[model samples]
Target: MSGIHLAYDLSFTHTEGRWNQPGAWVGSDFPDVKMFLELARTAERAGVDMLFFGDGSGIPSTWRGSIEPAVEWGIQWPRQDMSPIIAAMSTVTDHIGFGLTYSSTFMHPFYVARLLNSLDHVSGGRIAFNVVASSRGADAANYGYAQLADHDQRYERMEEFIAVCRALWDSVSPDAIERDRATGRFADPAKVHPIDHTGEFFTVKGPLSAVPSPQHHPVVVQAGNSPRGVAASATFADLVFGFGGSLAGQQRHRAMLDAALVDEGRDPAAVGILWATQVIVGRTAAEAITRRDTVLDFWTHEAVGTMLSHNAGYDFSTLPESFRLGELREEIIAANASPAGFIGALVTELGADTVITRDEFFEHGFLAASGLDHTVIGDAATVAETLEQNHADTGARGGFMLSSPLAMPSAYAELSELLVPELRRRGALAPRYPGSTLRENLAV
Candidate 1:
C-alpha cells in the first residue's frame, strides 16, 4: 500500500458559532488574511497535503423563507471567494496544495477554466478544483433562478462544463511559449490553436489566453453522493470527496466508484476518495469528550433547522405536527429539492411507510445538522486507531478530509499538531509532498 493522504477542510472555520468557541482567533476574524497565513505555515510544517475550501455563493434563505436564522446563528453563511485566500496561502508556504470549489451548474466553463489556470500558476501547480453541481435553491436564486435546475440535468451540464474546460486547457500546448530573449520571438502560433466547442449546455471558443500553468491543468476533485454523481466523478475527477459518516456507506461508495472507474476504462488504483470526516481531537480522551459535549450543546432548534433546510434545499420548518416519511420524501422530490439528506435517511432507516412526528424529525435534524452523529472524537492515539481501522475496512485508497466543529487554529491545531503526528509516528501516512503538483501528489 502507498499509505494515506490527508487534507484539512477549512469550509466552516468561522461559522456556526465557531468564532466564539475556544482557541478561535482572539484579534483576527473571518476573512482576515493573517489567521489563514499562520494556518498555511502551520499546515505546511505538519506536512499536511492540502487546505480545502468548499463554497456556496448564496446565504441561506430556505428556512421559513427567510435568512434570519442562518444570519443570526452564522450557519454556513458569511463565506469568501477563497481564490484570494488560496493565493495568499500559497505565497507563505510551499509543498502543501490548496483546493477550492466552484459550481459547474452555475458558472461558465471558460471563466472557471481561466481562473483555475491562473490559480494553478499562483500556487506553483498546487491548485485543485473541486467542481460541484449546485443543488441549493438559495444558490440558484443568486444566479437569477427561482429554483434549482433539475437534479440529473445539473449533472449533464457539469459533464459539458468539464468537456469545455479540458478542451481549453489542451488548446495551448505546454511548450507553446517561446521566450527567446535574443530573437525577441513570442509564442509559436502553430502550437497555440483555437478549440471550437459546442455542446448541450455550453459553447466555448478558443485557446485560453494565458501561459500554461505549472501543471498546465489543475487537478479535478468531485463529490457526488448519488449513483449518477459517482459516475460523473469517474469521468474526470482526480480525487473524490466522500462522506465518512458511516463505514458501510463509505465502503459502498468505494465499491461503486471502483466499478465506475473500471467502466470508464480508467485504473481504479489511480483515483482516490478522500472521505469527508468531522473531528474533535484533543490531548486526552476526557478532553476530547468535553469538546464533543460543547459541540452537542451548541446548536439551537432554529440554527439546526436553518442548516438542514439550506443544505437539503427543503424547508423543514413547514413540516406539520406529523407526517408519513414517504410522503415527505416524495414532496421534497416533487419540488425538485434533494431527496437524499436527512429525509432520505429517515425513509431509508425507518421505512417510507413509517409515521414520524415533527419533534422526532427535529430530534434527528439536530444530529444531522450538527454532524455530531458522524464525527470522530478522541485523543490522538484513539483517533489514529479509528482512522487506520476505517482505512483498512474500506479500501485504504485515499485518506481523509478532516473538518473541525471547534474553532479554527484550536481544532485544526489538534489535528495537525496531535492527530497527524500520531498517524506519522505509526507510519500510516503517505509520503509528504512527494511530488511537485497536486495532481502528482494526490492522485493515488
Candidate 2:
C-alpha cells in the first residue's frame, strides 16, 4: 500500500450551520469564488492530494414534503456546479487536484464527458470526476422525475455511464492531433475514430472533437456503500470514497469491495478507499472538545428531519411515533430509497427487529446532520493517532478525507496547517504531490 493519502472534503464547507460556526465563513458567503481560490492555495501548500466537492442540484424538500426547513436552515442547499469553481481554483494553484461531482442519474454522459475533458485541459490533468447515481427525491424532482429510479437500476446506469465516458475519452487517440506547422498539416484521420456507442441508457456517435488532455481519462471516483454500490465501485472507481463513521462498517466495505474486485478481474490492493472523516483540531484536546460542543447548539427538529429525510429519499416526518428498525429499513427499500445509510448502520448496531421511537430516530439524526457523531476532535497528535489506527484497521490502503464542521478558510487552515504537518512529522503520510497528473499523484 502507498502509505496514507489525505484529501480535504470541501463538499459541505458552508452547509449544515458550518457557515455560522466560529472561525468559519468569516467574510465570504457561500459560492464566493475568492474563498475557494485562497483555500486551494492553502491545501496545495500543505501537500493535500485533492480538494473534493459533492453536488446535489435541488433544494432539500423531503421533510414533510416542503422546502421551507431546508431553506431556512440552509441544509445542503445552495450548492453550485463546482466545475467552473474548480477551473478557477486550478489557475491559482498548479499542483492540487480537484474533485468535481456530477450525477449519472440526472445528466447525459456526453455533456459530462466533454465538459470534463475541457476542465482536464484547463487544470493540466488535475481533475477527478466523482460520478454519482444521485439518491435524493428532491434532486430527482428537479430533474423532472416523479420518483427516483430503483436503487439497483441506478447502479446499473452508473456502470454504463462510466463505460460511455471511457469510450468517449478513448475515441480520439493521443496521436490524433498532428500539428505540423512546417507542412501546415493538422490531421491524422486514421487515429481519430467514432465511438458509435449504443447502450441501454445512452447513444452516441463519432470521435470526441477535442485534443487529449495531459491525462486522457480523468480519475473516476465513486462513493457507494451498499452491496450493489460496492460491486459497481469495484468495476469502475479509481478511488473509493467510504464513510468513516464506523470502523467495522468500513472494514466490511473493504472486504466486500476486495472480493468484488477479484470477481471483476481487478486487483483490490490497487484501489484505495478515502474515508470521509470529519475532524476538529485545536492546540489542545479541551479546546477541540469545546469546538465539538458547538455543533449541538445548531440543530433543531425541523432541521434534523430535513437533513435525514432528504438523504434517505424518504420523508422521516411521515414516520410513526414508534417503529421497528427492520420496518423502517423495509419502508426505505420499498420506496426505492437507500437501505444502507444510517438506518443500515443502526441495524448493524441494534438488531433490525429493535424498535425506535420517533424522538430517538431524530436524536440520532441530529448528531449526524450536525456532523458530531463521526467527527474526530482533539489535539493534532491525538487525532493523528486515531487516524493511524483506523487506517490500519481498514486495510491501510487509502487515507482519511478530512471534513470540518467549523468555518471555512480558518477550519481548513487548521487542518492544512496543524493536522497535516503532524502526520508528515510522524512519517505517516504518503509522498506529497509525487506525480504530475492526479491519476499518478493519487495512485495507491
Q: Rate the local accuracy (lDDT) of all candidates.
A: 0.88, 0.89
Instruction: List model 2 lDDT by residue over 188-307, tens digit each.
Output: 888888999898988889578788888899999999999999999999999999987878889999999999999999999999999989999999999998988888777888888888
Candidate 2, residue 278: Cα displacement in angstroms equals 0.3
Q: Pick the candidate with the highest TM-score.
A: 2
| Tens-digit lDDT string for candidate 1 (303-371) | 888999988888988999999999988888788777775676667668899998999999988878888
- What is every candidate's alpha-carbon RMSD to the true fold? 1.3, 1.1
RMSD of 1: 1.3
Give me candidate 2's TM-score against the actual structure.
Answer: 0.98
List where candidate 1 sits over 4 angstroms from the true fold.
none
Query: Where does the lowest 10-residue lDDT sum fall in candidate 1?
Result: 340-349
Q: Clash number for every model?
A: 0, 2
